[model samples]
Each structure stands twice: as C-alpha cells, then as structure tokens.
Target: MIVSNPKQKITAVIPIRRGSQRVKDKNLRPFGDTCLMELKIRTLMQVPEIDEIIVNTNSEDAIRIVNECYAVGGVKTYRREEYYASSECSGSEFFRNLGEVTDTDVFMYCPCTSPFVKPETISQCIRAYAERGENDCVSTVSQIKEFLWLDGKPLNYDPSNAPNSQDLPDMVALNFGVTVIGRQDLINNRNIIGKNPRFVVTSDIEAIDIDTPLDFYIAEQIYRKTVIEKLELLE
Candidate 1:
C-alpha cells in the first residue's frame, strides 16, 4: 500500500519511462551492484525533508521492483499512460497535466537521470524554500565553466584575448538534479521552473546526467570509484 505524510507538505515526483533508446534500460541498468532506479529511491529515502515519493513511470518492471522492495521506504509507483511517455506526446499539455497526478500544493520534480545529487543539496534547498517567500521556485543548476560557443560567436570568452577560465562570469545551465516548484505554477504555466526561481548550485560531478551509452559508462565508473569503493573500505 502507498503512504503519504500530511505534515511535510512537499511531495517528490520522479518521472522515468520504460523506453530508453539511447542507453537501453538506463534506469534499470546495473551500476555498483544496483541500478539508477534503486539508487535514486535510496538517496531520496535518506532525506527527512521528502516525506512522500511517487515514481511516475510506464514501466511494469519498475513498478514491481519499487513496490516489492521500496514501498516501505515511502516509495510508490504511479502508472503513467504509455502514450504520455512516447515521443508523439505533446510536451505542453502532457507536462501541464503531470501536476494533477497528486494534490500537493508544492512538489519537487526529481529526475532519475541525475544520480549523484547530494542529500544535503535537496534538504538545504527545501529548508531555504520554506524560509524564503519571495522566490517562487527552487531549482538546481551547474555553472558552465567550460568555454562555450554559439554558431561562430564566443558565448563566454574571447579567442585571441583568452582570459583565465576562472575569471569568466557565471553562466549556468539547469542540471535537473533537484527542482522544487508549486503545483499551481506547473499546471497554470506548463513549466517546471517558474518566473521567479531560486537556483541551487551543484558541482559538475553531482550534475552528471545519463542520456547516452557513453554517459552510462562514464557515470558507472565514477560512481564505483567515488562511492562504492569508498564504502567497501569501511566494511
């Protein structure tokens, strides 16, 4: 049976799908003796700030796995329609209706792609959001420290007068590691981040998002070295 914590107020909705053409079973694929799907639940379960977790996916395997092992951890699966997870689905209407899946006033859209998001980041952001009233949303971002280009133009640096990489102004991209937004704002605007958003800065390592075969390989190695091996040392 599913569980809900009325006092916490904020719900965590994780949207993942069965069809992964790039990495193939990306979420369920093995990593450090566990998969991304398992690790994500394990990570969120550790955070006291997140009381309820709804895994919104169209995968039967995913639903069964969560219900069997993770339901007790306040994790449950929402049976998303197959069409909505398809490529033909309309981005605007489909995303807007996602907020309707649950009635929480506020929710955190947790992406399963980002595997290394720290519990401290999520907990701190939630506390910050609760304290700040002026900001409408709290979302994670990673600063673009690399030299960027748009067409032929230098986006953040000059070619000939090359300045030190550290000297460049802050340019950030949505890392989608931790995103908290109002339910009404998502339904009304058909957006994740609102007009006024509070950005939570994450490190490049934490911002590793898996979308391709190469990404899976890279993240798997990193997780093993930085996480699994370290844990083994203690044992």
Candidate 2:
C-alpha cells in the first residue's frame, strides 16, 4: 500500500449534505452507474497516497451508502451537524469544523461535486502536497485565459486594446476538485486554501463542479459521453 509519511497522515475529508437547494439529493442522486457520493468515495479509494477517507454528511442515506459499500478500505462515514450542512450557514467555518472533527496531520478537502476529477489527478495532487507540509496548501484549479467581465467592466483586459486570449494573463479559478492542507493550517485560516497556496492545473472537463441543475445535466452528458461515443477516459 502506498502510504503517506508516518509523521503526517493524509485523510480525505468529504463533506456532503442531503439538502441541496439547486439539486435535491445531489450527493446520492443516480449518476452514470453510481451516485456522486459513491463515485467520489470509490475514486478516493483508488488513491494509495490517501491514508484514510471520511465521508462527512448529514444525510442518513449518504451514511448508509458509505457504510454499505465504502466502509471498507480505510473509508468510513462521519455524521456532521445538520446546521453546518444547511444553506443558511455562512460556510466560513467549514475548514475549521473539519479541523475540529479529526486530528489527521493533513486534510484533503475532496468535495463530491466534482465527479469528473480523475483519480490520477488526485494522486498527483496528494504526492505534490506531501512536500508542502504546513507551509502551503495545494489545490486543483483551471487556468482561464478568456476575456472576463465584472460589474460593467473588463476584469482581465481592456476591450479597446484587447490582446489575444492566449496572450492574456492566466487567471486561475478554484474548481475545488481537490484541496490539501495541514489540519493546523485549516484551523488557523478557517479556509482550505491558506495564504501560501500552490495550484495544480487541471483539464477543463475534470474541473467541472456540479452545482446548479444545468451543471448536473451537463456533467451527466459529459459522463455519458464515455458510453455513448466510446471516448477515452475524460477525453
């Protein structure tokens, strides 16, 4: 078994909730052949660098699924407070809450939303994060070189003197496909990405995080592309 350093254990912390305003039971809803929760847990299990996997959730169904299929192979479920899982909460304490739950040396915030985040990508991120320690957090992001607009203004370029999109400064957006940080750093910062965060660039398809109904539908189509067109994995 490929393991983390004995001094610093890496645990995958997956937080899921049943009450998704955008899409009901998103974590447990039928996806491709398996649901998001099951798919994510399975994906994490493939990463040998991850020492442990914890499915933190407020849904009984999510807990049941984990206990049934994912309970083995260092994967288990942790019941979190329902209030913390609700939409009303500010979510500022998410990392701090995770810090309070477990004492693992390192925490990988692997959300189930990004179902397409490849296992190899996750393993690579974990390997890179092993060297970061408490100094830096490693996260997956997609480089956006396209023209961006904000509050009636060009965010990344001047419209009059626009350069080719390729020539524009690459703006990295946090897709949250995966985030690795030390427990202490998570507690100290109250966020997964601390002050000194290193980014691992992921492909556009792998960076898809299913949030809205349209996002869920699009992800399903992207996923089904495998069976429909016989495309290569995540191609």
Candidate 3:
C-alpha cells in the first residue's frame, strides 16, 4: 500500500517532439479514440499525487490539444526550444533546461511512448521515492530472467557452465516508463538517474514502449483487449 503526502510537490513531464524518424507523427497518432499524447495526459491527470502535469513539446498541435482539452486541471504546456527539440541533442542538455522550466520539488519523467503505464505504477514510484529518503531517484524496470547477450557474448550467464533458467540471476532492465527524480539531482547530475536510485519492477504489459509501427499496433491491441474492454464492462 502507498500513501500520498500533500506536502510533496511533484510535477509530471512529458517531452513530445514533432520529429519522429521511425513512426511519423507518432505522438499525435490515434491510439484508441484519442492520440497517444492525449491518452498520456488523461492518465497522468488520474494520479492525484502529481501536483502538475507539464507537456514539453515542440509541436504546435500538441500545445493546442492540451490548451483545448487538458488545461482545465493541473495540466500545462510549454513550448520546447528548437535546440532541445532535435534528435541529435543529448538528454542531459534538455533535462538541464527542464530544471529551469519548472519549480517543483520532484519531477516525474513520463514518456508519451509508454501508453500502457498505469497511474497506480506512477503513484507507487512517487510513494516509494517519498518513503525512501536516502534514494535520490526512483525508476521503473522490467525483471528479465531470460538469457541476455551483448556483442555476441553471453552477458547474464556463463557459456561454459549453464544453469537452469529459474536459477539464473534476475536482471532488471530500465523501462523508462516512469522515473522520479528531485529537482536538485536533475540540475546536479544532469540526468534523471541519480547516484542513489531505487528500482520499481513492473509487469511486461506495463513496460511496453511504443517506438515503431509494430510496437504501436501491438500496444493498440493490448489497450483495446485489456483496458478499453474492462472500462466498457464497468460502464
């Protein structure tokens, strides 16, 4: 169980740029009834612990959508600078600027590509961050027990001595679905992952990140099959 602290001010940041090389207009593309960006905004609004939801995007379309539909609550849009909007720009460079954009105690970095990320997961991450005073950052990860290799070499296991799949060490891969970091850490470290970071393991469904056309199709199917159907049944 997670408890919310009213005193802690947390801001949710979603950075959506118009230039997508793989999937054209991926953020603005329709997921179900609404686009991916709108769905993320709506989902973020459900998390009560989040004090404000900031949509940092270079697209004018995104700004218009937020102003027209999601500006009612704690949601606000910020026009991203041209330099920060490019694909060649480093995350640290943009995040450094983000520290200047908002004045919240903590920043919840939520990517719009992760449409399946639940509000419960977001709340849990925030609560874990709050409870763990020693940790400067909390990030969502997917636990994998399967064989992993890099550069044609076994990474998680020894080739000479093979062990049972269950006996293999559980590896946690950063999902980047939800990350909680303090403003001071962002400015100091120039990265979301702080020195002392806590990992929150999430399910495979919740870890689904849409980056390509196939990914988008698969996520749409999952949403319609799982989330939308459940909501319809309740109604």
Candidate 4:
C-alpha cells in the first residue's frame, strides 16, 4: 500500500519536580559549568523542530535556571500543583495540563533527569511522528542478551543461556528518555501512548536516565569520557 506521511507542528515539555526521592536537589546538581536542569534546557532549546519549550516545574530555582540559560523565547512555564507535585502524580497529568495550554499538532515530553539528548534524536522522533501518523512515540532501545529474573519463587533462569552476550535474542525496551505524543491523543486520552504508539530507536547512552546518585555519577563519568575530551580538543 502506498503511504503518505502526516505533517504536524511540535512542542516540547520538560518536566521538573522539586522533591527528589534519591538525591537532594538533584536537578540543581552540577554538571561541569552548568546545572543538570540547565544542561537539559540548553540541549532541548537547540532542536529547531521544537516550536515551544515548556518547563513544567514546581521549583523556582529550576525556573530561574531555565530563564538564565536558555535563549529560546518561546519557553513557557507551568507551575505544578501540590497534588500533582508528588511522585505519585502520573506523567500523563502533566501532559494533560500542557495540552490544555499549548497549541501544537504534536507534543514531546522530556524529563530533567536525562541531560545528554541530541538535537538529531529529537528531529528523528518528530519526523517519525509526522511521517507515520502515529498517535504517540517514545525513545526505545534493544538488548541482545537474555537476563535472569528471580521472583519470590525459585530462579527463572534460561537453561540454554549462551556464554556470549551477542548470541542471545534481542529485546527492545522503551527508554522514556524522549517521549512524543500526538496533541489530540495526549489531551483526550491523557496518556503518552494513546491509541497507536511508535517506537523511535535510540542509543543506550541517549536512553540513560538518572534515577539514583549512582546513576547520576555514571552519567557524569560518561560525559567526561565523551564530551569533555572533545571540548579539550576544540581548544
């Protein structure tokens, strides 16, 4: 069947929370010369397809950091309510409110935790959404190795597990590092994945989301190994 791509406008939502369960003031935590939140804001602002970069945050410090770092004038702010501020608050609620305020054909959601997003990744997801006419899309990754799962019962290990990692069957997993949702679907369904969802493939590095102090430290190490070394060469 001949296929036609859907073309739609895109907006970005970067959500930040004041209360961090793992690390204290994690968003404000330093990453080289800038804070973690600032790094994400700056990175998202660089994407040309992003029509608007909205910061859905409850922290005034986070708001101030974005104002100071990002040059994107279309940046909008959403003050998360107390009920919605808790960790219990579903991400869909944030999108629901965002959908109500903004006017865009497609919606993109990024968490403050993942700071090393590339402009190309954003563009690719945007292209996928527009071309495929999918209701929603999220950054995903594939694992080629089998894993052992131990529930409350006995071990659930594969009997014929291969010694080599590359020999195992690949498993594709959603990264939630960069999620894109169609405007109407996000609004009506109040979900990132509405009726139809697409998976936008991305690298493991791009999918690394900081959930704990150790995760943050690992990100820092990766950044130093990859980014800092390059900056040094530019000099």
lDDT of model number 3 = 0.87
- Candidate 1 shows a clash count of 0
lDDT string, candidate 4, 76-125, tens digits: 77776766678676778866776776677777878878777687887777
Per-residue C-alpha lDDT of model 1 across residues 159-213, encoded as one tens digit per residue? 9999899988798999889888778888887878788889888988988898889
Q: Write the per-residue lDDT of candidate 2 for residues 40-122, one digit (tens) a residue.
A: 88888888777889988888988887787777665888898877787666666766888889769888999989988989999
> Model 4 misses residue 8 by how many Å?
3.8
Model 3, which residues run further than 4 Å from truth?
Answer: 1-7, 232-235
lDDT of prediction 4: 0.71
TM-score for each prediction?
A: 0.91, 0.91, 0.93, 0.83
CA lDDT of each candidate?
Answer: 0.83, 0.84, 0.87, 0.71
Worst lDDT window (10 residues) for model 3? 1-10
Please estimate how well model 1 matches the true structure, expressed as its whole-model Cα lDDT: 0.83
Q: Candidate 4: deviation at residue 17, Å?
A: 0.3
Q: What is the Cα-based TM-score of model 1?
A: 0.91
How far residue 156's Cα lies from its native spot in candidate 1, in Å, is: 2.7
Native-structure RMSD, model 4? 3.7
Tens digits of per-residue lDDT, candidate 3, 1-235, equal 2334556678999989986779889899888777889899988989988888999989999999889888877589889888888867898988888877877888889988998889999999988988877888999999888988988999889979989888899888898999999888888888888898999998899999988999999999888988788989999
Q: CA RMSD for every model?
A: 3.3, 2.9, 2.1, 3.7
